[model samples]
Target chain A: MKRITIITGHYGSGKTEFSINYALDLMQQGKKTALVDLDIANVYFRSRERQAFLEEAGIEVHSNIYHSDISADLPAIAPSIRKVLENHTYHTVIDAGGNETGAMILNQFARHFLEEEHDMLYVVNANRPETRTLEGAMYHYHRICDESGLRISGLINNTHMLRETEAADVLKGYQLCHEISEKEGIPLIYSCCTEEILIKLKETDAMPVDFNPYRIRLYMRPSWLDR
Target chain B: MSEKQLMKGNEAFAEAAIRGGCRLYFGYPITPQNEIPEYMSRELDKVGGAFVQAESELAAVNMAYGGALTGKNVFLSSSSPGIALMQEGFSFMASAEIPMVILNVMRGGPGVGGIQPGQADYRQATRGGGNGDYHIPVYGPASIQETVNIIYDAVTLADRYRNPVIILADGMLGQMMEPIILPEARETVTEEEIRIQKPWALLGHQDKKERTVVKSLRLQPDDLENHNNKMHEKYIEMMEELPQYESYRLEDAEVVFVSFGSMSRIVREAMDHLAEQGIKAGMIRPISLWPFPNKAFDEISPKTKMVISAELSIGQMMDDVKCAVCGRFPVELLYRTGGMVPTPLEVVEKTKALLEVTK
Candidate 1:
């Protein structure tokens, strides 16, 4: 297991959703885990939105990160985050913000984690406006690295369009991510989809997809959607 | 024609702009349209052009205004909220009678709405978003291929009237991929060519003529009024040119769907499904939403008894559709707002229900 994993992507790319579930996935794999919210760019749909649920599941949660306060736009790096990463025994998963504006906050504290073994997972929702094409996806990747002073270690394909997402949508996203992963020489850390899609994939292999895809439950939703 | 390559709408917009002799590009990041600036930055560098990812949409539009004064065809793209921020600059460009090509890859909104395809900006685009007595000739292309062609003409059209022109597309078109035959690259407009063509362009007085000024501010009320009247005359000339719209299967139809942009493409699918069910229907797609091809309504078959405004918004474009029909036919609205697209089946069902009730 990676010592520390940072998840970042374009705004509304569903990085926060992937971050929350990824921490749970770590816990399920029998690893001591802690989730950290370093998102300061977006005011809604941060990893902290589910802090209560995460804590209830016996996972440690770090909230109010990046100098957070009632004023939502300012960037302030919290020093306690380094303490969590230093706890060698536990795996730390930090959910970075939507784009460069959010990921740039890490530049302030890059020194503490520079030597530590960490994987910067660039989460991409192929359907989102920012990652609709290869050039667009590459631009965001470069911007995040330029801002945070960190290199992306892997690519996570988590393309979706909320409840309207379909099997075809899943395949479209996988195709782009698969090509990018090959060209960039980065690992495709499993394409993400709901369990329903997995069942569909099993019935017929119309388009080719790399194995080792992760099944995800939809956790990123507005409160009005919850029944 | 070059072999068709699979291209996203935003990428096609950039490629089309570059081929149209647009060198100076000013843009900011916004969803559904970020690919535009991303493509421009990489591709423009190769063409010896300048591409600045401005800090904000406000700054980007202003930069575009300055670039236009230099007599180069300038390009800029933004989504709904970001376009809202650039309204002031657009107004300035219109008043100065400067030529510019702008693209608004619209998303759902009144404010910072969802990053999904929306046509709520119909009024914003056609009626003019900026504060002014001006109308920005807005072209609404429904497909990726059409986006390329329209952007090609939009540049010339902007120069023809010395006014700002907008390619008003939506989020779906921006993100969707389609095989499009790229147009032949046009020769870039050189400094010498601009100097000769645009006599009023603000290239410093090289001891040949008096200094040229490009300013929107007119201190005297009479001067501003005269300028506004001149703009109205240009608009009259634009209207006389005869706007474009696609009439699909309008003959022998009893109902017609009025729509544009990505929504119009979806409506075409719905029309096909309606045909499959033996429900004869037609479509009137407004290519230029600003000039609004209202004359198409006169071409509707006498058998046409109803019109449905199939839009991506809650009946915003319905206003124009109403005027087009002029109460000759009952017009109903079939729409979904805030990132939810109108499905083909939903539209087919909605049209059938409206037909049944009206009958």
Candidate 2:
């Protein structure tokens, strides 16, 4: 995570989860953090659901829809989004939804962070076919850049298979994304996985740097995991 | 369908649907089910069939009805909110007694809830989400293999009774990847068979027999009553002939747990835990949620003191459980709502607590 991190990826690539984890990590590091839920294209798993928990951790949170009513379906991006953009002092993570549907919304807020040093990170999941290769990852990356007019400064390897993800699987995604980052000239800022999987990489040489990546815990638990 | 492949659950169902002789698919994009259309658009096209991305679910179902009217096996799929929009078309299809297969990759909902799997559409699927006194035959499958088999079999069942069939699967079953042995593929419905069987097909009579009218409308009071009675008779036949359920370790166990779909798999785990602790527990899983599989209710163990309706919804299937039990035994509900799935240990703890209170 950086001064300002805008997270966007293909649908089911887990962008919101990445954004939530990055914001929490920044807060744990004793930095002022804020997560903006610019996910108007999707209703489920929006970052807004964790607002109270994030606020309890002493970080500000903004939702795309302000109404507590689920049926409201109004496109009210929190006014706080603009406020967060203006400040630039607090670590801000803007969570975008999947596909061009989600990236198009970022166009409105993309111009705000041009003056600041920002990293719009494309979270790539290798398990999905769309982001499995450089071409697949670039398809959405180019579209997000084209739609938002905001360049992706870095890439994050956030591979998963729901609860079935293993360390090897995450490593496979990291290798693929690392190449994409290198070819595209964007830095590979992080390779995220659950603390358990992350711990597996501790003794291995899978990571680019020993302690550079963030340890992410699974936040969205859909039914049928048998847990 | 044959040979095992580690395919995503949604793609498995789509492939199986095509093999089941489904020629046309009309659907809109929604999470947990996008793979169905994605796979269908690619594969169905290869089979010399068509996949049309409809403007809306409302349009999708109507397009399905139009396709099915021509006596071609048509398929359509959508998630909760999208399914909600297709209710009216479902009703009209039922009134006309048209044959079509629809898959509901269910999501959390009373409104725009979570994208995670939830069994909240139990009533909407079984009891009919659309208007009129109609019953949509719904199958709640627990596995990818079962999902493939059901999607394959559902097309024929829908055609057999000339009624719509809904494969009510959750997002977990749709999103998870699993190796499955596909069912033997069924040949595409031939035009000759359509002419002989579905004489009501809109594929022009060729001046041979009287032109047919395929519609739900019968303006006259007597005619409409006759149509309704005919549809009702088919539902009764479905209830009598199409009740399919599973009874697991249920012979002499106590505290029979009644569950369905993905929730039953977890309950099986909970049953294992109970057995390890010397608590004999069994399960009655209704594969077909509509007919309620009331027969499984009679198989409740003699040692059973409580019938637990464990599910992912806040007691949606419990209503049917209570009805089936009909006060003959104490029926308890153990459920988790809002896309939250309970673990096997959690279910065991809850069951033990309920058992203690009942004791």
Cα error of candidate 1 at position A86, Å = 19
DockQ of each: 0.05, 0.10
Over 4 Å off, model 1: A1-227, B219-225
lDDT of 2 by residue, A1-227 (tens): 45788898887777878888888888989888888888775544567777777889887987754534452335787776887877857888888877777888888875676745577888888877557777888888889889888878888887777666778777878888878867888777778878878777776756555225677876654444432
The per-residue C-alpha lDDT of model 1 at residue A18 equals: 86
Q: Report per-prediction Cα RMSD to one decimal.
A: 7.9, 5.1
lDDT of 2 by residue, B172-277 (tens): 7887665467788777778899988887788876876666887777789998888888888988999999899999887787789998888898898889899999
- TM (chain A), candidate 2: 0.90
Error at B330, model 2, angstroms? 2.0
Please, what are the lDDT tens digits per residue for candidate 1 over residues A18-104?
A: 888889988889888888888765544456657778888767877575332332434555667777777888888999887898898
Point to the candidate with the largest TM-score.
2
- Residue-pair clashes, model 1: 2
Candidate 2: which stretches are off by over 4 Å? A65-73, A195-214, A222-227, B1-60, B77-97, B105-124, B127-135, B142-149, B169-200, B207-241, B246-254, B261-282, B311-316, B322-328, B334-357
